[model samples]
Every structure is written in C-alpha cells, then in structure tokens.
Target: MSIPENARKYWRANLKYLAVLLLIWFAVSFGCGILFKDFLNRYSLGGFKLGFWFAQQGSIYVFVMLIFVYVWLMNRLDKKYGCNEPNSRKK
Candidate 1:
C-alpha cells in the first residue's frame, strides 16, 4: 500500500491546519468562556463584564472570524498544494 507523495503532503497539511484552527476555537469557546471567566470578569468591555461578554457574545464573534480565517487559509493551502480549483470565468 503506497500513497503518492503529493497526496500525503496535502493530507498532512490539511490536518495540521485543522488542528491548529480547532485548538484556537476550543480555547476561545471553552477556555475564555468558562475556565477563565472569573479572571476576565475583573475587566469590562463597553460597560459589560468581559467574562460575561465572552461567554455570551465574544465567543460567537471569534467563531465567525475563525470561519473566515479558515476559508482564507484553505484557499492558500490549496494553491500551495497545487490542488486549487480551476478559475471559472467567461471572457
């Protein structure tokens, strides 16, 4: 059983990116939202406690930003690996 070198590299890169992004997601969603809330609560954001904001709002914002970042990163990765989709245009 043998895998092509390019395929192996692509999968490795994909998984690496996946893991990093997921870790960040977990940290924001769980760590800030739950574990460090007390510490964060000591601070305030826009008249709201930071910890409460993170738990109720900031985590969601972070998640949405992460999604955009993931898309941008993956597009770059696709180009790097020469697996990008063909340009589709009528010219």
Candidate 2:
C-alpha cells in the first residue's frame, strides 16, 4: 500500500535527519572511539578514560538525545509545513 502524501513528506524529512545523525554517531563512536582512541585516552573524565567512556556510554546517551531532539524538531517542522493535525473546538 502507498503511503499518504503527508506521511511520505514527513518520512522523507525524517530519513534525511536520521542519515545525518547516524553519520555523526558513527564518526564519534567508531572514529573517535577506535581510530583516535589513543589520543582521546590522554584525557580522563572522572575515573573513566574519555575514549572508553564514549565508546561504552557517551554514544548511547547521544543517541537518546538525538531521538528527543528529532521529535521536537519534527513537531516544529510539522507546524511550519502545515502537516500537524488541526484541532477541533468543542462546544
């Protein structure tokens, strides 16, 4: 079954955002965690090595934050693009 036009537009916009976010996530998680790990380990946060923390925890936190941010941004986009459902007034 084909998606409704509004849904297609919303999904296309969301997909673009997801692609960019995933790229950044991969760069930080893989590139910084493994490739530049030695350099990153030179810094420490609390008792944890910075690179280790990022590899183990920071990326997960960033991913969660991205989800919330995406929801907020998409809500705004829906309003701006008139894709948000209209509210009905009650008597």
Candidate 3:
C-alpha cells in the first residue's frame, strides 16, 4: 500500500532532523575525541583538557543534551503534523 503524501513528507522531515543531530553528535564525539584530539588538547574546559574531556565526559554530556533536543524537536514536529497527543488537562 502506498503511504499518504503527508505521511511521506512528515517522515522525510523527521529523518532530516535525525540525520543532522546524529551528525553533530558524531562530529563532537568521535571527531573531537579522536581525530582532532591534538588540536583540542591545546584548550581546557573545567580544568580538563578539552579532547580528553570529550573522550571521557564531554561526549556523554553532549549526548544527554541531544536527547533533550530530540525530544523538543519531535514534540514540535508532532504538533506541526497534527500527530501530537491531546492535552491531558484542560481549563
């Protein structure tokens, strides 16, 4: 069965958001932690070398933030596409 055009467009937008966020996460985690560690090591954050922090704790923090971002983005997307759940409490 063919999917509705609106559904297709919604999924496309959702995937786009996923792709961009994932790419950012990858760049910050893998790229900064490993590939660019030397350059990042020159800087410090919270007294820890930047690259080392990324490899150890920074990535985890970024991932958590990204989770929140994804939730926010999805909530907005759902509202835009009329897929959000109805409010549980009404005045």
Would you estimate the TM-scores of all the predictions? 0.87, 0.75, 0.89
Ranking by lDDT: 3, 1, 2
Pitting candidate 2 against candidate 3, the one with the higher TM-score is 3
lDDT of 3 by residue, 7-88 (tens): 8988999999999999999999999999999999999999999999999998889999999999999999888887887762
**lDDT (Cα, 0-100) at 41 in candidate 2:** 92
Model 1: lDDT to the true structure: 0.87
The candidate with the higher TM-score, 1 or 2, is: 1
- Candidate with best lDDT: 3
Best by TM-score: 3
lDDT of 1 by residue, 1-91 (tens): 8977887987898888889988998899899989999999999999999989999999899989988988998899888877686763223
- Ranked by TM-score, the better of candidates 1 and 3 is 3
Clashes of each: 0, 0, 0
Q: What is the per-residue lDDT of model 2 for residues 1-91, given as tens digits with 9 covering 90 to 100?
A: 8867776787788888889888888887897788888898999988899999888887888888878888888888788667677662223
lDDT of 2 at 56: 89
**Model 2 global lDDT (CA atoms, 0 to 1):** 0.81
